[model samples]
Target: MSFVAIDFETASGYHPCSVGIVTVENGQIVDEFVTLIQPPNNSYNPHTIQVHGIHPRDTQYAKDFGEVFPEIQKRLQNQIVVAHNENFDRNVLIKSMALHGLHYEDLNIPNRWECTLKIYRSKGFKPAKLSDCCRVMNIALNHHEALSDARACAYLYLLR
Candidate 1:
């Protein structure tokens, strides 16, 4: 029942503009980490901004993925990682690492993360986006905001 639930909001392409990690132990949340990240070249897409409300200016002075990898590594290495949409979040992590010349193999996490979206789908939850599942389960959510999404993903996993 112990795991780390993570979420990432991209600035453009697979470049992470923000990240959130929630650590759970014995089924209870024990720690939470969230930070805005400077994407490659501190650039952002207008469409992504509409999704997460994070503009280039929001992370202009924030640390880049390389600068923040140590923190991400300490939490995720050798841990059970979960996400609402595992494929997307995992790709963001891997691609962001690659963008910064960091190797994904060094993290020692599984290639496939536990996915709440897929899990809920299997259990017959239709329209199982993070927000949809959260709404059905009465879990509070802030949608594309990384920390809130991660926290909601964690709660949904616990319920599952």
Candidate 2:
């Protein structure tokens, strides 16, 4: 089966500032994409930067979420989207889209998406934190970076 693993690092609240996608086909990674996004109002919180290390300057000239939504939609629409934490990433996508005047219902996204953290927990793993799961499973992880986190989630899903 083929699927896409996704992750987003937000600038503040639920505003996605960066996105990462890893496409897997027949158990092999087929493609990957990552980009910094200029969020609505170009706003960001200091704490958010501490988590993901993305600064406003980094996305100053980057495309806004509206401009990047088409590419994101193309990758995720009608596909199984896997993320470490579906709630956060999914909400980020929804909120960011709304901020750009796009409606989540209009995106044609799958109603059910996969969460690696949930999968790990279901397998009796107590610590489902992405880095912890990666360590236990011997998967390399770069923690907070969106693309690295997405690739790690893909690897964990592949192992499962």
Candidate 3:
């Protein structure tokens, strides 16, 4: 019943432009952390921008991954992590950390985070995308915004 639910919105190629973390303890949400990140070279892919609506200018003044690593590490280290799509979010964390010369192993978290998508799918939820699952469960969602997505994912995990 205790875990951190995470969501990442990428600028390009697994480079996180924004991250959201919601910490739950004793089945209650205790903390919510969210920040926009300036991706490498402040670059963004047009297609990704279309999905997340985060333009280059939005994060131009934000901290890069290395600058934000301490905050992320403190929240995630040795914690059970959950995500809507575990693979994508985990890969984003891994690749982003690698880009900043940080090691993912240092977090001491699990190799595979809890996945709401898989859980819902196995429970017979059709079209188990975050938005679809949210709709079925009446969980409010703002789609690709990282914090909203994380919050929704957290609620879905709680319900599951």
Which candidate ranks first by lDDT, i.e. highest? Answer: 3
The per-candidate count of clashes, in order, stands at 0, 0, 0
TM per prediction: 0.98, 0.95, 0.98
> What are the RMSDs of all candidates, in order?
0.7, 1.2, 0.7
Candidate 3: clashing pairs of residues: none
lDDT for position 18 in model 2: 92
Model 1 lDDT per residue over 1-160, tens place: 9999999999998899999999999999999999999997888889999999999889999998989989999999999999999999999999888877889998888999999999999999999999899999999999999999999999998999
Runs in model 2 lying further than 4 Å from the true structure: none
lDDT values of the candidates?
0.94, 0.90, 0.94
**Which residue runs does candidate 1 get wrong by more than 4 Å?**
none
Candidate 2 residue pairs that clash: none
| Best-to-worst lDDT order | 3, 1, 2
What TM-score quantifies how close candidate 3 is to the native fold?
0.98
Worst 10 residues of 3 by lDDT: 95-104
Q: Model 2 scores what on Cα lDDT?
A: 0.90
**Tens-place lDDT digits, model 2, residues 1-160:** 7999999999998988899999998999999999999977789999999998999999999999989999998888778889999988998888887777888877676765899999999999888899999999999888899999999999999998
